[model samples]
Target: MSSKSLQARYEAAFMPNYGVPPTVLVSGEGCVVRDADGESYLDLIGGIAVTSLGHGHRGLTAAIAEQAGSIAHTSNLFVNEPEIELAEELLSLLGGDARVFLSNSGTEANECALKMAIKFGKQHGRTYFVAAENGFHGRSMGALSLTGKAAIREPFGPFAADVRFVPFGDAEALRAAVGPECAAVFLEPTQGEGGVVPAPEGYFKAVREICTDAGALLVLDEIQSAIGRSGAWFAHQLEDIRPDILTLAKGLGGGLPIGACVGFGSAATIFAKGDHGSTFGGNPVSAAAALCVLKTIASDGLLGHARTLGEQWAAELAAVGHPLLLGVRGRGLWIGLVLDGAHAGAVQEAAKAAGFLVNAVQPDVVRLAPPLIITAEQARSFTAALPGILDSASPQE
Candidate 1:
């Protein structure tokens, strides 16, 4: 069928909350995906940073297939080898004494962490939360309460009371907001959806101190920035600080769906069993996929590759000095290109026309989170073509 026909069928069968997808993706390999119409485009967004190793990775597929043929589900009633092994691998990667609660998506991970935070507060007679404005958590009730975006969060309203919002990257605001009544302070080391904003210098370190003093749990949402997406094992590692509770997902399973909520120090013992559970959170197949992703990322040295190539792409784009360009920020393969005006949608459409895929994360911000395995030659192709793409969008006088 054609793209139009597929789109019609999709709209008829599914809700329009996500809007009609622009392309009907048929198959993908490496960094390129073919639409139903047979046109191929470079997948620079990596499915919004979920496809860590890129499309159709041999090892990733093999791991999933092998695990599937053996066994796929065992529920929480029974333990599975791949699930246990995945937990061990994750704890090792995080490099600390922690307890892991597996889940099916980033929001579920945040939900687990949120419950832990609230429970910790209950123990000490506290009942409040702090999160960054414009930050994107998950969409579930508990996780949505921690998200900072008003447009997406407010309508769900009258959320859990005492939830406080602070300016993104402002240590002072965070410090002022977190107090004795605060149960936890939720933050993202790098704000992936808030135009790929990074924490200011000394911010994470200061927040750590403030949370410690206030006796509040520090919850770092690394859903989008973890697993080498930001050129580091964890974004918090780049800041040299550790959170009491850490939420991870997105790239953990490459393309498969899996998430984890990990607790450290006193936070590790917050849950007292029977408090929560997930039916298919870390099933054998997904666990195996996640294990493969972590192993491949470590052995392939994709962290350094993401950092080096990302820096080079930033420099190249900056050198062009296009009329719509403002600046670029972010680390590793996760980048946000800020435009002069609200022209990101225009640029995204133009790039799609030119056989490239990018995300208009915000009105004026274009976020690029290509697969970590994307080569320099492939990346420079987009960078080289960017000037023309920008010109086609909004040309200067």
Candidate 2:
């Protein structure tokens, strides 16, 4: 069917929440996808960084298929092998004495972490929360309350949590905001939705120290920066600091859906017999998929690959020296190409026309969270075409 026809059908059937999509993607393989019109484009954003193994990867598909063929769902009432294995693997990567709560999405993982913090803090007479400005936890009500962005968060107001917001990347501001009454401090090691911004050097370490001093929990949301995206197993580990709680999703299950909330130290035992649970929290299919992703990332050495590509791409993009370009920030595969003006939209459209998919995360910033398996030739193609794309998107003086 034509993209226009499918779009018309979509408008008639679905809610207007996401607005109109530019194209109707039919299929994908490796780092490329095809629209309904049968045209191909390099899939750079990797399904908002969800497709860690790229599209239709053999290992991921086989694992999902193998598990689905044998068994899929097993409610929390029963135990499953993959579920146990996946949790064990996550804890292993964390290198801590921790417990994990599995769920379906990043938001759910954050919700679980919030509940853990709340329960633990209430016992100690601490009920307040501290978060970073421009930080985005999730869209659900509880997670939304901790999110500092006003535009997407304010509309769904009257939230229950008493959260305080401070300027992101400022350790002193965070220290001033956090107090003994604070249950926990929620922050992202890298703020993905806030334009692929990385935490300032030593910022996480300072926060860890502050949280420890105030006897509060430190929760780091690594949903968008984990699973080899940050050139490390976990972004916060770059600073050699361990948080009380860590939430992960996005790339954890490759292309399948899975989320994890890992609690360490006192936070691990916060949940009682039945504080919270999920019907599909640890489906065998998703757990198996996650196992495959973790194994493949390590077996293939994608962590070092991502680290090298990130450095090379950042340096190359900066060297392009285009007039419309401002600078670059972020770590590993997650890079934000800053623009000289609020022209990221125009640039994104121009890039689409040139057979590359990208995200205009902000008016003046283009975010790139390509798959860890992205090849060198595929990356250079975009860098080679970026000058022309910028020229096409640049305004006439």
What TM-score would every model get versus the actual structure?
0.98, 0.99
| lDDT score, candidate 1 | 0.92
Which runs in model 1 stand beyond 4 Å of their true positions? 395-397
lDDT of each: 0.92, 0.92
Tens-digit lDDT string for candidate 1 (1-397): 9999999999999998999988899999999999999999999999889999999999999999999999989999999999999999988878877889999999999999999988888999999999999998988888888889999999998787468999988888888898899999999988988999998899999999999999999999999999999899899999999999999999999999999999997788889879999999878999999999999998999989888888998788778778789898888898899999999999999999999999999999999999999999998899999999999999556
lDDT of 2: 0.92
User: On a 0 to 1 TM-score scale, where does candidate 1 land against the true structure?
Assistant: 0.98
Q: Distance from true position, residue 27, model 1, in Å?
A: 0.4
On lDDT, the candidate that comes out on top is 2
